[model samples]
Target: MKRSNCLIEVCEDFDCSSKRIKTSFIEGNNSSKMFRNTIWYRSLLDAEKSCLKEDKLKKIHYKFQDDKEMVEEYNVDTQVLLRRAWKVKGKLGGEGKWDVEIGDPMPDATPHIEGIGADFMESKDQPKLTRRNTRINLEWRIRNLPYPIETYSVSANNDERCIVIRTTNKKYFKRLQVPELDRLNLPIEQGNIQCSHSFNTLIIAYKKPQQLLDMDKEWYLELNRVKPIKDIPNDCKTQ
Candidate 1:
């Protein structure tokens, strides 16, 4: 999707750097169309159907499956560069029609199966957005860091913090363990994002509607969404 109010661009000249990360999403559904975590969940669903058909047992029993299983290869296209490179997304095919559609994720919509709804964070999945969030329709980020969106309202008078959100409210937000670190080149620390951004980019990603309105700060700033995510000169590490 075309990126505007890009976090990378706004923070670039500030000597901030950001790494491209491929984050996974798990969707579930009863239909043929896949949702995040469709693979394993689908398998379980099929197994459940099979067991029902073949069960000659008195009482049915099942094994407890971990919700955070990473047996599949799920990834989204990500294009990250110097914060000053707002055009970078366009140059690298990261640009496209994003916010124009009505189904795109917004304040209102059914949450993803993983529970990622009401969060303003955007993703790289096109068809998903066209289908899901728009009522509708849906990126990677640094390392394996789980980007918790923090929105704020700042203007001439009052500055307010509003929200703390991840794409969905699933295991991704709670449990971020992945064996595919080397495979996806995702960083190892889910909490070290602040320190990491000090070396690469600002490590901060902001959304559109730059206009500052009054918001809630306690919950919002708690996610570390502020002007100073990291100290200055973090981008020099890349140079």
Candidate 2:
């Protein structure tokens, strides 16, 4: 199936006093559909009682349900909601309401935690991931190669659930995993991977699978419908 290659703009307005948060999503393409299929659960057992649409989640829930020890071990409240598309850390309120608070705000009045990305690195030699808003393919740039296009090779190792980058001369080698796909229980398919070299940088582009696209669409819609909190104290407002 063809994927819908569109970027979503997510805006979050949170109120710490009320422990409430509002998330909004604006799609680049106006034709995007909005869904209201929000499911809430206090724990694994609670989620198992509901109708979950995702197969991976279903399998996990079933496994836990069938095992008495596992059920007892995971029956406690976690203050987090796991859905087919995304996980929301908060308390489920009445009906569709949800109370979300990441943590205490910093002196600058911003939350301590932010979102995740493929580009985050701890060292300078690591491959840098670049997410393009105009395209659906994810790009990873490895600099300081100083090698021609034919000197490098990139391929997917599905058994390991990662993509391997290697130099023909054995000078450099790196294994990069797509954590986002792992959350969705997707495998690394060779057909969706491509690479090239430009200005001593080896760039690998992975086309997003259709399941991920649909997950994004669902996640965006749920966040867009969240109501914004009002009467936030001045200290809670960002500086």
Candidate 3:
């Protein structure tokens, strides 16, 4: 299957006062070479593993579901997600760290304490722990193959977002027609396809507001193709 390396950027905007947050995946430049060995991608994988571990711990603590059943389910799920990650090892990689920045940091303005005065005082004293408006930027590389995506999902955990992309070998590549793709101005015919071998990328930003975590919240996604300079058509080539 033909493949190309594309850049993906997810920017999260959080507004503390209004309790609003917007998450967007921005399609950036592309190259013929796949960046499997970049620092950003490695960090993303590490963060994803951490998130999954935390999730497992939470499930064990809550006991909302059967532990045996949950473990079996996650075991299968982890295999699917990590299949591609294991293949990117032993390659020359890029350098750079994934960044997280807080915008307009401040103390909690609310005076009243929900618990005892001692607890309230301790909480109020920790300014850094208070929620505030923030922006998080995550960058990674994705290889667009000739197969179309079959199923995918994105979820947020406090400050991290996990993205899962899955496609079946039986499917054929078609024009990308999703509204989220249109919003990012990426062409459907840009070789933006996916298959089971595609790697999952994770982005962790500032904490998402509770209001924005509703099931109805909107998300934007775009897949841009990466092509070799020699293979790109003249019209699509950068001057």
Candidate 4:
């Protein structure tokens, strides 16, 4: 499969075209000069196309049978209603009144806790312990492919609202924080974090600004691509 990046502009916009993007890339990257770049994503137009089609939501109305005033009775936000209408978060509410199912009702505000990522020497009940499940518990993901993350610490402030993932390279240490939406898997607008161990990098991708309607086609201008991304770097100082 051919790998590439592109933008989708409204046809009315005279300055935008997929070919124009390719010509620019060819001029910049000598490595890709001879290869044919394929695949272009246009998100806006695709959304428009999808919206015009007949309702794709298959109305399975068994659960909402009991509630007569389903739509008027339920209290949900616009985003929540959209999710329910499409059955993305699971069929919620009742059968005919289809609602999106929610998990254990969490506090309206987000909750986050920090755990350690290192080794333990003696029988001390250290709060941070390393195990297979560490991957799931750890909030910060390290991506260091071309280089290595020597050591670091994670700090959260303002009731866990601000999170900083710091890494050291012996000579200097840099701190990268997790964005609010990324902390909870919430889509802000359109973006992704693509990790490739083979390439030794974790690519933080942003949606092509001009891509009008193709949501699937993204121009990942590698934000943070790293290799050998380990939970714990080899050189962690014992506390």
Off by over 4 Å in 3: 1-28, 31-37, 43-239
lDDT of 2 by residue, 114-179 (tens): 467434524566554433211266556667678888888888987888899888899888888676
Off by over 4 Å in 2: 1-135, 228-239
The reply for model 1, stretches above 4 Å from the true place, is 1-173, 177-180, 184-192, 195-239
What tens-digit string does per-residue lDDT give for candidate 1 at 74-126?
Answer: 11121111111001123465532212111122233435555555355556331
TM-score per candidate, chains pooled: 0.13, 0.44, 0.15, 0.17
Best by TM-score: 2
lDDT of 2 at 110: 31
TM-score of candidate 3 relative to the true fold: 0.15
The best-first sequence of candidates by TM-score reads 2, 4, 3, 1
TM-score of model 4 vs. true structure: 0.17
The lDDT per prediction is: 0.23, 0.46, 0.23, 0.25
lDDT of 4 by residue, 21-138 (tens): 8878887654332112222122111221101111232111111222221111111221111111212222563322223221111122323434552333332322121111111121
- Pick out the ten consecutive residues of candidate 4 with the lowest summed lDDT: 129-138
For every candidate, C-alpha RMSD to the true structure in Å: 27.6, 20.8, 27.3, 21.4
